[model samples]
Target: MDDLVINNLSNKGIRTGKQYLEGLRDDRNVWIHGRKVQDVTNENGLKSCAHTLANFIDRQHEPKYINHLTYLDDDGDRCALAFKTPKSKEDIKDRGKSYYEWAKWSNGYFGRTPDYKNASLMSFASASTFLEKGIKGQGGKVMAQNMVNYYNYVRKNDKVLTHTLVNPTYNHQQGYKGKFSEKVALQVIKETDAGIIVNGARLLATLGPLADEIEVFPSTVLKATPDNIPFAFAFALPIATKGLRLICRDSYDLGKSHFDAPLSSRYEEMDAVIIFDNVLVPWERIFMYGEPELCNPAFSATNAVVHMMHQVACLKLAKSEFMVGLMTSIVKASGRDKDLYTKGLIAEVMQMTESIRALLFSAEEQAHEDQFGNYIPLRYPLETSRNLYPRMYPRMVEILQLLGASSLMATPSEADFANEISEDVEKYFQLSNLDSKNRVAMFRLAHDVAISGFGSRQALYERYFFGPPALMASSYYDLYNKDELMERIDSLLSE
Candidate 1:
């Protein structure tokens, strides 16, 4: 691991599945079933899927991503992930180009990669640099430490990380005092010099098993009543940390073969219910606690939204582009390309996806500097994507399913294609002069995106990813300068 070569690997994210697993096993806090998991590295249900994602990270080290996605650090002694944010309008547009460069490789499948976590951590790191002298906010120093550790760790080892912010369930009606409160929320039970003891759980720990660490934070605005202090905490724990368990949802890939579940098995983003049983967060790892007002705002004040918006919008747009291309290809192959109805359907999908791409790109190009001096994507455009994509993506997926038609539903199992019934299955289902394997591959992709349990989960993920539309709309309303808009409207009316 010489400086130059290590730097090269860091640029490309060259870590392996074995390295990632070892990292997860390295004193991480993770549990499953009734016992603490000692070997998530090779857990039957989790191993292969985790490894598949690790391979994606490994690819970053390859020549393809080494150039655009990796860059020399200011010191020139280290290499860093290459992404741009705009301090000016021109830079903002350039940032959008950078986002597209990264997104194209994923075709949107790998939206929440370790790079995404890095983006958030970098924002935290940048913001923490402005901490007022002689005053350390609750958990803020811990957050700074975690960010530094993560960046250093990733730079040296090329490992990827993922995190979960929200508790598993939503109980909007229940305040902290309600009996149903703790049942749906994760809260602190005790405090210690080593760290706070958290007892309860978090949800949507996407990629939890694969990540080297799980950074935990509240997903919503926290109110600091005496009872709610524990809920307003932030910390990072190794995935294997004691008393932490990740209860995975029912697997969607089980119903279909790998060929048919193309994205489901590897692209599942395997979200989980993370239960913490008095789990200890070392002082170094804690980011916030006992400050409800600061918790939500602290997260909001950073460049997190800008970074996240670029990642998802770019990835989703790429995916939509692929889908549009795929549907067109399918239509051409099926001899329905000229059909008025089919053309109209595809036109609508194209319009939606392209519009999303345009807005996402505009947001990136329109980025601006925050008070902390890091670049942030423009608020309105990113907010619009955050609002529309959740609704739009499902529809895009639905149209893909519709275009797939009987092909998506009636595909023969891989077993059947390999068995005594192979001839019959092939003759009946294979389409457009393509062989069984190619056609099956297309159908499998469609199943994963549209018909399978993966499809259902994706729909749910989009609907609640940035909170419900109401909450999102409220954020937009709050952040937007209504007074300026009102003044402009008044002037127009006077005219």
Candidate 2:
């Protein structure tokens, strides 16, 4: 966008849901189902998610939720709670509580809550000085200030952001090693007085169509060689930026009623492949430019990932608890709550849920001051939660399927209850305790969570939320403080 737009951001503490939707009527090119969507707020498969997020935005203005989701800044400006510079342990706990509150809005179904990116931006901005250090002392002071400016700008306007990191992989082997091909990877192809011109495609920008802007950051560790410099920059642009096109996966909503596809109806946040076709990223928007040494450690050095994990930890807790609730409802409706096998399956979910809850609490209780002077939840516990929840979520889904059994498949559509065969459906579909309508409704929700396309995608999303399970495990192993544990083993042997 031009300087006029950047410099004229709205100072409104929080925007209404209608205002948020209206702002999305920009020039963003979003395609789905072999057609370019003209308006996400009105599109059949995309509208529900658009308005769901709008409600999330509007919740910031709600009296009951406002205190949890927002806070007054030093200048007395009411900024999003995610943007608050967390300075103490209490701040960490408060943030965690707020994250849980937001997650409950969708029973943890809406994975890409705006607060997720907001947390990342807040962490980076709070530690803006690290960006000032540039790789090998390259000119980074300006970029540091740019980040500070962008953070304040977004917080003031309450802008919704989606971010892209990974580039499309034509070859699995090369891609796994963080290799980028010029034919497909987004990179700087030319430089102008105004900014750098980027072209090529990136994989997996979630919430791309509905977001106000997109943050295109480094995808992975860069080699820092002259050859790799072009691909090492970080920047943000309005989603409506000219030449930026988003090709989204087929939407899962498909206009299903809330009763028929409860989760899908409310939480099909779009994922897309972003193609930056000679897109110009202004100098003011560049957070990192040709600095692999700095870019590689950007998230870690600034403790941004730790704070990000804190947010994810709470989300996982919400999700896990939601699964437990779903399972309980399933068993109770079938009068199988007293069955030992049924109890065994659900108990496992409860155990897993409690483990996640404990890990989140441990991280918060162990909060410490980082070098950036901001308080961050402890990494190991949060890291463990991040690494473990992916594995846990799928197993929980499996347990749900096991417990749900025939009832999951025996579900009747909401339409069936009003049809001529309504009498047959009412008599046959009734569970031990639940009548036809409520039973069908419960199982439909269960189907949406376990058997439907929406449910399957959720499993896939969690499995790779932090990239490949092997990579996450390897990173976890490397980051573990194994030296102390090894010493303990050594002392035992010596003894």
Candidate 3:
């Protein structure tokens, strides 16, 4: 049994929050506002989130949450529940419970939790046989076994991961279809006995700064041809690996009081464009490479896409439920709960939340065993959730704006109450049900979700969370049960 889950992790139990933060003090290249960040644990904007994620990790060790967040492995190590492979329908349901719990902890604002990547790794590693079908990569031929080893390593060590899937395109149309530009996109520049040397950049690693490692997987649109061979690969690397750089966008965490910028203060999972300056990906780190045809359907064939979708559906459900709570709270505080229009607005959000809940249940309830002996939640319902959420989230934000009206913007800052105008602040800002201080706190959270720079970025992030909506819808159409439905229509037409 000691050999069941292999690895030599420092702790045989879940690591503490402090230990998690200590991991981020590495030599990883992270830049903000044109200057290199020396330490993510102490930096003004990034440090807040670095610590916030650490807190999330610490929850796994708490007496109250330990059982919910983790389980003891056969090897005697208490591991994260996220790494558990679903062997039966009951296992699928249990995984869903853990996934939803993780999402709800952050109130759905923290988009890239470690469990999200863990789910993908679990699926790929479970179906490690699929990787064996690909052509021998430049790194070597043991890609499938490498995947299983990588999964074990991450699980035993409890590593936080970030991933980038798309290459930045100068010419949009051509670049996205795996026609990566030599100078701009991340493509293999050379191969040696050591490993493959990669260069150029990839976009949208949501937690790049805080992650211990990064999964550089293939873009969904990669084409199968000699021209695209350099771009067809998948591998993981430690964030501290030499020649890897994360160029971040401006941070939304402006070092504000939690009362003033609730979500922004604590949930700033920074997005960055990754630059790989001839980084060496060792043979053991390479999961698949040199087969674009294999790369395109790898996720689907291995059932990784379905598992990732299950995680996402749970996340979106939590997010939508949070909006419903925010809206209902706004109405209760403002004494608008009895108003017909207010009830109507809040009910709409409730419906969207329920819609997400229904889809998640549908996916899980319809779980089936895959060729790899993994019981995966059905992909269709989860796919529907993914396609619908990017559209639903923006409207959910809008519902907040409509309900809050001027309250979302006119809220006083945390500083206003402590300064000389304390009396004035309390006197003027009070609502019918909420005192001035409480009112400000609630509305500031709403502002962070609906009106602030953080809010706008969230809107944009949701809009394209899984890529262009049109493209997603097109693919959904392609995957729909048209043949079965059309057969019934043909029978009716003949009658």
Candidate 4:
């Protein structure tokens, strides 16, 4: 372990926080609203979020956080904890701690943090056989090598990768059976000795503008037919790749002071629709191509979903914990902690927090070893976290709104406390315990969490982050085992 730590400290491939920031100054084509972003590193709407991620990277070199954020690899090179492929119970625990630590930086609001894709790459590396099995050709060995190389490249460099999995929903009413439009979804337009030329678009590439690379994969189920083959491919490319364009939604950062828009000001992870105009995906970058059958079960078959959700479970736990803190502080400051109704509401929030923590621990405790010898968190519990949290998150937001109540509306902006009406504002808004400024700040944070554009986006993002709740529940039902309960009932009837 010490060697691993030492190796990471000395590895050139491992980028410092400053290096990470500087790397984003590339000529990537990123358009927000109508304007093309020249440099994401310095863009006002993107720089703060990029800086937030850079801080996480910087922490790896800080003595206080280095151990918690990173580990030395088998080769004795230091790597981010998120890139570690768990081979034991301890490894999972260590990785979980790192995931929790990173999630805390954004209070679990930034969903596309580097750790998210790092876990995916770790999963892909562990289950390289899946990649080999999915591809058909004389180039099977070459494809396998590519997967290994890509995984190593990402882990070594600690690359920040954003993914676009779902196709645009433009013609969803026509459904999958109708003639598939080539222009609407990313598809292989031409194949060459150099690589494949991919064209069309994909939606919801969270953090696309700020990432080092963009990974494209299948998110929705696909038919195992020739018509869908062109769209079943998966690959990763540098964000600077020519002809690749990211058309972003409006910036939510709003340039508000941190005291005013606490979450959004620092954690606005921009989401965009990616358009590939004959983008070249090198042969070495392609993971799966011309295979819809493999694309559909890519997550389950590779156990990537479980690993990815392990990171998300840690994130949800952090979010719930943050909510618990917010609710407690709100109730205490408002002098409502003693109220039975208030206590009940706060307890409900606590229960949700503990529920997420319980699932996280249970999944780690009952960890299973995959065919590749990686110790993965138990699928059922992790999946349960993924399924239940979407439902729980909105309620958690509502509880904040309820606890804050009218106080949420009464708070003044940060400017009010700093300007001409400072004395008058402070006199009127000061709470019994918290200073007026602090009280206002707390409410401002609450408002950002509950009422602002940032707050609303967080709710909607969590709701459909893993797709529709009902579909996920039904899928879980179909995947889960019922044989034991049925057998017990049969035995009872026979007796």
After superposition on all C-alphas, the RMSD of every candidate to the true structure, in Å, is 4.5, 1.4, 2.9, 4.0
Candidate topping TM-score? 2
Displacement of residue 458 (Cα, Å) in model 1 is 1.8
Candidate 4 residues lying further than 4 Å off, grouped into runs, are: 1-11, 173-180, 489-495
lDDT (C-alpha, whole model) for all candidates:
0.66, 0.86, 0.87, 0.83
Across 24-133, the per-residue lDDT of candidate 1 in tens digits comes to 66554444444555566565556656666767655656787665555555445323352322346654454455556666655676566665666666666666653211
Ten contiguous residues minimizing lDDT sum, candidate 1: 1-10
Model 4, position 34, has a per-residue lDDT of 82
lDDT, candidate 3, 85-194, per-residue tens: 88988888888988898899888888898989998998889898888886754333388888988898888888888999888877876755657777788899899997
TM-score of 1: 0.86
lDDT of 3: 0.87
TM-score of each: 0.86, 0.97, 0.96, 0.94
User: What is the alpha-carbon lDDT of model 4 when measured against the actual structure?
Assistant: 0.83
Candidate 2 residue-wise lDDT, 1-495, digit = tens: 552155455664677889889989876899999999888789988889999999888888889988888998766778789888899999999999999998988888888898899999998888988998874566788888889889888888888888888888878776666567889989899999998999999879888998998999886556767777888988999998989999999888878889989999999988899999999888889999987777877878888788888888888888988888888987888789999988998999999999999999899999999988889999999989988988899999999888878888988788888899999999998877888899889889999999898889899999986667887788899998899999999999999
lDDT of 1 at 234: 66
How much is the lDDT of residue 333 in candidate 2? 83
lDDT, candidate 4, 1-495, per-residue tens: 121121133333468888888878888899986899988978878888999888877877888888878888887788888888888988888888888988887789889878889998889877887778766755555666677777787787777899988777667654445335666977888899978999998888888999988889876567778888888888888888889899988888988889888888989888888999988787778888887887778878888888899999999999999999998997788688999998998899899889999999999998879888889989899899999998899999999888888888887888998799999888998888788999988998998899888788889899987776876898899889999999999999999
